[model samples]
Target: MTTGRAAQARRAADALRQRIVAGEFANGRLPDEQALGRSLDTSRNVVREALNLLRDENLVTRRRGIGTLVTAHTYRHGLDRLAGLAEELTPYGTVSNEVREARVVPHAPPAITRRLDIPERSEAVYIERLRWLDGGPLSLDSTWLAPDIGHPLLHRDLAGRDLFALIEEVTGAALGSAEVTVHAVTAEPDTARVLDVAYGAALFAIDRLTRLPDGRPVDVESLRVRADRFALRAVLPRS
Candidate 1:
């Protein structure tokens, strides 16, 4: 496809993806390509390409005469706002955590140290968890927290609470802000086994640095989220 047509297809796919997430498609079926093309003000070929894109993402399936079928996941996590996994997924279903590892590390790696803005030799608390939504694994999170804020969590219920809430409760300070960077990464062998996806499957990798209201960095987290089970959303303003 030409660059212009490719762009149009992407735009069309994005629109349809949002509609699918919003439950706009009745009975999980989309309108015919010609009808979609008319509604989206694009060509039938463009709509076909758009549907193909969604199919590649495993969000839809095209049948010979039955039309397009929506199989997209129901949860849309907002990228514009900072919230815990449990908090964001609350509207959909119960979010639970299986704490894999939680302990105080005497020395964190250089990369983690830099993200938390701590000395290379500084002690940090490390917590690894597999987050589940309604009994299915959704994300695998590896978090490193500055000693001060994370020490109290050593004995707390890590599996039953949101990490952000735990941090605030432990420190008695509200979380101020967070810097998040999200990108796609292929699942490695260990990660794939943990999340139950095929090796080399695409996954969403989010690296976040969260801070206290006073600007002191407290937490740095790396999360691998299942692409097939979640969608990222954001509203941008043109100013």
Candidate 2:
């Protein structure tokens, strides 16, 4: 059970969290505790409690002389939520895409054959793209889709476009939950060349296979993101 003071602190924290997410505060700086307490109709101690919670969440920093400052540097991806990459990243900064490889091929890689339920040497669309945030490389996404499923995308302009949105709009399929697996791997020669990282630099490999509402499999995505540029956060309740 939460005490009244704790509950009040949570409410204050929730309000500030929304404003920070909306980019209302300039340079991620929150006002002084006294000002925040007055605005929220709470006491200074309550405001401090709220700021402490946000600090624990990695959303702000509170120093004695410096007051409170927001320190949200990397994108915070919620593990319990499902959203398009654009929606996930747009809040941080401008997003752009560079389509590296977009074409229908006659062969499906052996690894994805079992996942896509296609035989070896089956037709598939292979798309390799680099995602940029504020003109800097952020992630490298390699996607393989069933040929008939993804060939239609070739006609559309893919540069600077959202992959999940394009697929949903074209296929009219309600994308369901994604089965994601995360791994920490060192960049290979090819990955290093594309991501502009050292040959053996650290990277995070995120593999996702999405399904439709009706249980139909779609594309398989292998995303290699700079480890320092991204993070995953989850809120777990006591069982």
Q: Which prediction has the highest lDDT against the true structure? A: 1
Off by over 4 Å in 2: 1-72
Q: Cα lDDT of model 2 overall?
A: 0.81
- Weakest 10 consecutive residues of candidate 1 by summed lDDT: 71-80
Model 2 residue 144 CA deviation in Å: 0.3
Judge candidate 1 against the unseen true structure and give its global Cα lDDT, from 0 to 1.
Answer: 0.90
Q: What do the candidate models score in CA lDDT, each in turn?
A: 0.90, 0.81
**Which predicted model would earn the best TM-score?**
1
lDDT string, candidate 2, 102-197, tens digits: 988777778887788778878889999898887778789999887767988887767767778778888887677789998999889988888777
lDDT of 1 by residue, 1-239 (tens): 45798999999999998888877885889999999999999999999999999988778999997889886456888988789878999888888999999999998889888888889888999999999988888899999999888899988999999999999899887899999999999999999999988899889999999989888899999999988778788998989
- Minimum summed lDDT over a 10-residue window in model 2 is located at 71-80
- Clash pairs for candidate 1: none
